[model samples]
Target: NQPGEVFYTEYTYRPWIQIDLQQFIVVTHVIKRDIRTPKVPPQDLYGMYVSKRQWDFVNRGARACFFGLTENEYNCRRPITGQYVTLTLEYEQDSYLDALMDLKVFGLPTGCGRSLGMTTGDIKDYQIETSSNYKDIHQSRAMQGIEGWCSSATDMNRWLMVDFIVPTEVQGVILHGWYQMKRMFIYSFVVEFGLQEHTLRLYGEDGLDPKIFTIDSIQDVHILQKFMFLQNILTRYIKIRVIDPSNDIACFKAEFIGCQVYGNKL
Candidate 1:
């Protein structure tokens, strides 16, 4: 939140607000709120842009546009990877002044990794399934929920699966274990993905053979862990099979990081 009068650009041909995230992030949406003034009207039109290079918004072009609103949220059609986000206001006159109450940008800090929509709820509860879940801790809690997915203590061959419903380019996954008691830290796991569940291929160092990723047992349970594929996998389904679970429980929150195979630029 910001004071309405704090951020103001003097009258200019292109009144804009640029935010530096300081690190690359995959931007999903941007929200702008207007600061009502006695004489100056809110911007009627504006452009939103994201880019790795500082001036790419001007070089490549604006990513999207918003119109006829005092406050608006611009959802990017495709996840954009960038270190900078700029919102440029358009006015009919040669020069205009703009004031904003607030500017918010939502994204995942995966550098060039685009979101697969897990954080934004594009992946629903039914789209996620587990081999078995602990009592009352459903698979739906695997992502974006306080209680993450946990497998039954007695269940073997525990695995969590996600169906994107369309072929997506998956680059990596982000995982978080149970945070409260040094529990649910995954020690080792195998990643499998494919267009069909039955014909899934193991994601390995060479993208051809089977390999299990190992994690230190003493690692912090509350910290996020990221696993990147050697090469991007184009698939509709992905499964994480626990090879060695922390305290024999396959429990964790997971986000599959990637983007749609085809979509218009934001």
Candidate 2:
């Protein structure tokens, strides 16, 4: 198709493109190319890209790149498996419509969804709130169709702990703030990775567990956000704490990335 023949949405409505895989599949990655304008990609011509599932009205399933495409890549920080994968432009149609030279989606047709975190494993004991489910912390969707985790108290002390049962090689962590219903998003939070020998100890007694990476401040993160460790971390336990007490509400869903290192113990 000629450059002028490229599809452009009517400015009166939101601009977005949806592709129905028709059947459910495990979406592993997505690659987008720029408009066929120059031999080398130009600066300031970049636009934000958000790969999502289902409808765009709801942001629960969104995984976005804050800025325009970085080096023309937007990998799903966490698993994004769905029947319909949608790509949307953050900015509305202005003088020019968002253009796409090419777009690609790579995945498997497993039908069942995927997650990097251990789905059925021992979790740290915590006070259960009737309105909130601790299990939702490991869920994929925020509030798209289900209620995600929300702390009963708002003292900046709320935490969600996960035990992998064995030492795992952790590469990164992806978080989804409460983007459903009232939209109680976690403005900021901190993550800590550790390893322990026994679950009965509650706390590591030998001072062996140490903090690997600290994300002390992140502002205005509403939907899916990903943080990858500088290097792979080997640990058995991972803790996420929401330390900002100003919001009066702290709610989120998260997934940890990496694989299990067989026969390895810390």
The candidate scoring highest on lDDT is 1
Off by over 4 Å in 1: 1-112, 135-143, 180-182, 216-218, 245-247, 263-266
Identify the candidate with maximal TM-score: 1
lDDT per residue (tens digit) for residues 1-266 in model 2: 45654565555433456666644456766766656454355343333233323453345345443235344555666565455666555444454335566667777774222244333233333311223343354342322435456665534467666666677776666666543556555655555656763332222223565333323235443445556555666777766666664746566666665655777344
Q: How far out, in Å, is residue 53 in model 1?
A: 17
Please list all clashing residue pairs in model 2, or write none if there are none: none
For candidate 1, the lDDT comes to: 0.71
Residue ranges of candidate 2 with Cα displaced over 4 Å:
1-114, 118-145, 154-156, 179-181, 197-222, 264-266
Q: Score residue 257 of candidate 1 by CA lDDT.
A: 65
- Which 10-residue window in model 1 sums to the lowest lDDT? 135-144
Which lDDT tens digits does candidate 1 get at residues 38-65? 3345446667888655566665464553
Local distance difference test, per candidate?
0.71, 0.52
